[model samples]
Target: MTGTDEGRLHTAVLVGPEGEHRRHRKARQKAATRIESTARDARKAQAKARRDAEQAERRNTTYLPSAGESGPAALRTPGRLRLPKHQDTSATLAGQYPFLAEGGLGSSGVFVGQDLYSGGSFVYDPWVLYQQGLITAPNVVLAGIVGSGKSSLAKSLYTRSLPFGRRVYVPGDPKGEHTAVAEAVGGKAIVLGHGLSNRLNPLDEGHRPSTVSDVEWAMQVASRRRDLIGALAETVLDRALSPLEHTAIDLALRDAVRSAEVPILPMVVDRILAPNPADDEDGRLAEDGRLVGHALRRLVAGDLQGLFDGPSTVRFDPSLPMVSLDLSRVAENSTLLSVLMTCSSAWMESALSDPNGGQRWVIYDEAWRLMAYPALLRRMDAQWRMSRHFGIANMLIFHKLSDLDNVGDQGSAMRALASSLLANAETRIVYRQEADQLGSTAAALGLTGTEQKLLPGLGTGQGLWRIKDRSFVVQHQLHPAELAAFDTTTRMTEIARKISDLDVPSGISNDQEES
Candidate 1:
């Protein structure tokens, strides 16, 4: 009985487990089918939801309803939502209107009053303008009528530039207006005249640039002396020297140099007139140099005496803020003035070429006097041409553009050179001109009709600045100190003050008293 029970139990266990396995398999298969169906439904629902979203988006993104069309939509007033046109002052609109105003000549340079057009501070600096590609030339030509404040403007330009490490070289202040300015700016003014004992030996080896080597300096001095002597002879003779004359002058200069540590014009004149035996063996040397010697002798014994007859009494200190040759004492004598300018120009040449000299303002005040002499004009032309290379800004001041006509004959090379000065100077400042000067000034400056009209109307301390192709009507504002320092009408003002000081009657006013 136990054996049969054991067999049945074993069979029952195997069959029972197999039946359970089959039931589990059926349940798992049904669960998997349900899961598959549920997943299929979920996928269908997702696709429907995605399609609904797409339809909603497309509906929402349809063409904006037309102006007339009404709907529960963003009420965009059709036809661009026009508003009443509005206007406001530029000062007020500056916030709304960006970039309408000039960003200004970047605030890096000197403050030169305000721009009448832009209604903002106008700044000017030749170096800054050059760096910014606004100007390729730094030389300036300033023209204005008498009592128009052009002189004040010129003085201000250079004096203001001094703080920026610039030096001023007023080669020839014929009226001596710059003497006070020179002394005021911590500079020296060399006043040479008939009795002042300020002898300016033209042969003096003037300032030698610190950067030049001994050899280069020697060559420069030799070349300068040779050129100077020739220029002097030409100035006196009123013509360029011949090659033979040049040779004779060169030989005389060499002899003078060998004879003294510092040669004088008298020595050169002596050597030229009374030739050396070796050089003038055939007497042709003396004949060739005869005219040049007599011409140069004018500096020593001729009417042009006392100035260049001896060594320089004063040294040209280029390191100073200003160096002005005050020629007022000798203003009546044109030859003496020309000789002094020539010597001073030679004295300044080395400093001008000095790399360490930084920036300089070479002001040629009363340029009319300078242009009268061909030698001086050529020298000025050379300085103007090389202004950029030497890092100097030359300012040639004139009473009017027509003053150039007084330089040389019509269509002459001197006139052309004078005109070239205006051409080379990219900056032209026209203060105030008479009505008659309008056409010539306008044509010479290439001023527009609008600009031409502005010349005559310019007031005191106002200038029409034509810088490179850009035009600006600037009202040069000076501080009280500047006005006091640059007052050119002091003589008239003093007379007025004296007239005003006169005891006025009970009913009379200061104006009446002045009148």
Candidate 2:
């Protein structure tokens, strides 16, 4: 340490060559630069190889087609997923993905059944909903295929509502499906047909309201009688009445009213067919009324006589819990069906317009049949429009929404009326429909793609309910008693079951078996 330190100190003291020190520093810097350059080139080579391999793999890769793979492999092949598993409470998870299901319509109204989406009980009441400001209209339109249990749903809705002090009035039941139900619910079913002793006078002064004066009622009765006579004529004629025909009907109805406190259709037909000279004024009045008189004559003395010819055997009691006109016997005759439904609707209209009628359900079963006539369809449209004012809910049932197409010619008044019925109905309950029916059904209902898809897949008693802007998929539950009362498949499927239950053997009557 002594010798070396001494030599170094002597060299430093001597101020060794400054050019030598500079050379040493420059050499060290050059060596370090060479090492860094070699390392950079090596890295570039490795990166190039990696990029080439990636490009080659991309070119060789095959992707699934838009229509997916063919054969059994179709849509089954996919890239492996590597997402990390997640764990969280449902409430916290809702923060990320919310509104998975509806909160529900609250715990009011009638208990309908189960809500498919919310996994809870569903409830619906048009009146309740209207009162709550959720809907403005109380009318409902129900469409479903035959045997789809739509009838059951309708029965359930109305019957369950009876306890709430609501009344039901089925103006025309073509199949008589509601007869048993009406009787079971302590209501009345007026069965009228060709052979039945029951009779109906469309001119019967229906229940009078205390709000109207005697003079006002008189005017209303006159106006109603005149309209009824004209409507009956048009229904039988299958066309609107001419101005001359209207005059004929008015004169005939006035004459009938003068003759009796409550005149029958026969008297009106007679007066129109043979107008009194003093009233005719013009000789052509008889001729002008001939066609209309004959058209109405059918209801009194012709083929359509048995039901409306004589004084009404059964009265229209608006105070009853329910009143359904059973037209099953007359359903086979189109003209009879139209005429009877027209009369029945007029009968119901008076009670419906009564301010004291309270809340009621006016059901038009097999509406397609009733809608065939222009006058009847118009009347239905009027009733639907006035439902809110009268505090009544009108439910129009259809085998399918396409039945509306059969009402009238395209763009005709009847068609517009049919469309309006759908528009006024804020609640639309659709049960199972055929594949072909989905398009028009969806179009008429304003259903989403999801709701439309739900139509064909619905089970029995299941319906997609669109109440105003809200949607609910409900599974309607039925009591065994209701099931028995609402069973329409009796003719098609229950005969064998009934037979098997008999203690007697097949083909053996009870008397014969006992003998």
Candidate 3:
């Protein structure tokens, strides 16, 4: 091997195929770069196309018109719907909330009227409420100003209940308004006045309960007589009888009873005025009973005479649908009225005690007058307390809620008793009242501010009923017959007529009236 040959062999060989391979490799690299560039561009274009399509779709989308846009579209076209804000108490709101109102008392009792809130019939019965445990006491306190239709509501509630086998007893009707109602319901109204033939003998054996035996009845009669005479003395004297006076009354009642089988009031009075020497162990017996005896003498000889000094001409038939003691003629005499009520209460005691006496309503109209007398007030309180036991419902009607304030002093026992009558009664029906009376009425009833406001706006026959824990605004509806029967404004509208006047049309005068 030569040096030139060795150098050539050691040096690189420049072949044409090598140059072509380098060019081919470069071309392959260029082709790969071009393919990658084209794929990247294609991807970029696809992304742009998708973005453009989305933008076009958004541009073409439709939306509801803004406020005041003109087109044939619904009136609801608006930027944002709005409404006026409303606010009310839960009590008033419960009434306004159409679906949230009370379901109402089940229709199992006497029909009252429409429940303004629930928009359903409002029916109430004491027995029904008692049976359902809605009320523990069956008594009612109805208060309203004159012309508010409280009387009619009371009349309707009781009269409508007559068909359900309940009887009514108005122990003292000062206005005689219940006289017609009593007669209309096939009941009796014992109208006792100075000149009337109706007499109420305080000493007569009143209605006897079937549960009472003969000896027991005699003892009860004796005890009732003694208590009645004592009460009479207290009422006439306007003070409680002392112990000696009570002893004297006992002796007189015993002697009177021993002498006559059915002794009258005069005999008891005579015996008290002149006690027998044998019974008067103390010479001061007559002197101790002098004032009491003379006080009781008023019923037999004084201003209160002729009413209780004789036998009971009219009987207290418990089976009657209604019985009212009409004291309208004596309403002007408060003491006399109280005396009559005392005797009447004693007379009613026997029938009320009857186990089979069934359900009854004892109404006390012009209750403010009755509450003034301690004896009568006590009697009423007892009846009210025993209302459930006797199966009776006592109704107290007053001209206004403030009448309770006049019952006695602010915190006196009489006042407490009177207020208790209201407290024990679960059903309190209040009608329209004067604005000035709202505070007292609201305070007495524990009414809310809204209820207090509602009172002044209540229309005729509209009432607010607070039953137990519930409250109701009721629009009392009356039939035409009831309206005519309960009309108290006849004197305001009725024209005076002569007996000799011929039948004529109402709108006709001497010329038009004669027609």
Model 2 earns a TM-score of 0.79
For every candidate in turn, the CA RMSD to the true structure comes to 10.3, 15.0, 13.5
Q: Can you write out model 3's per-residue Cα lDDT over 1-515, one digit (the tens) per residue? A: 89999878655555446877998999999999999999999999999999999999989998666554466555555456689999877766666545776777789988889999778999989899899998889899998899999999999999999999999888889889999999998999999898999998888898898888999999998888888888778888888888989999988888888888999988887888899788898688788788988888888888788887787788888889999999999989988998888988998888998989999999999888888888888888888889888999999998898988887788889899988899889999999999999999989989989889999999999999998878999989889999988887777555544434546657666876544
Select the stronger candidate by TM-score from 1 and 3: 3
Tens-digit per-residue lDDT, 26-66, candidate 2: 99999999999999999999999999999999999998877
**Per-candidate clash tally:** 0, 0, 4
lDDT score, candidate 2, position 19: 62
Runs in model 2 lying further than 4 Å from the true structure = 1-99, 498-515
Q: Kindly report which residue stretches of model 3 are placed more than 4 angstroms away from their true locations once superposed.
A: 1-97, 496-515
The global C-alpha lDDT for each of the candidates, from Candidate 1 onward, is 0.88, 0.89, 0.87
User: If ranked by lDDT, best first, what sequence of candidates would result?
Assistant: 2, 1, 3
lDDT digits (tens) for residues 1-515 of candidate 1: 69999999988987897889998999999999999999999999999999999999998885744464565454555447569999997645767854465445668787878888678988888888998898999999999999898998888888999898888998888888989988888899988888787778888888887778999989999999999888888887888889999999999989888899899999999999898887777778988999999988888997887777887888888888898988899888787778778888988888888888889999998888889889899999999999988999999999999999887999999999999999999999999999999999999999988789898888887999988777888888888888888888899989999977877679988788677
By lDDT, the best candidate is: 2
* Residue 317, candidate 2: alpha-carbon lDDT: 86
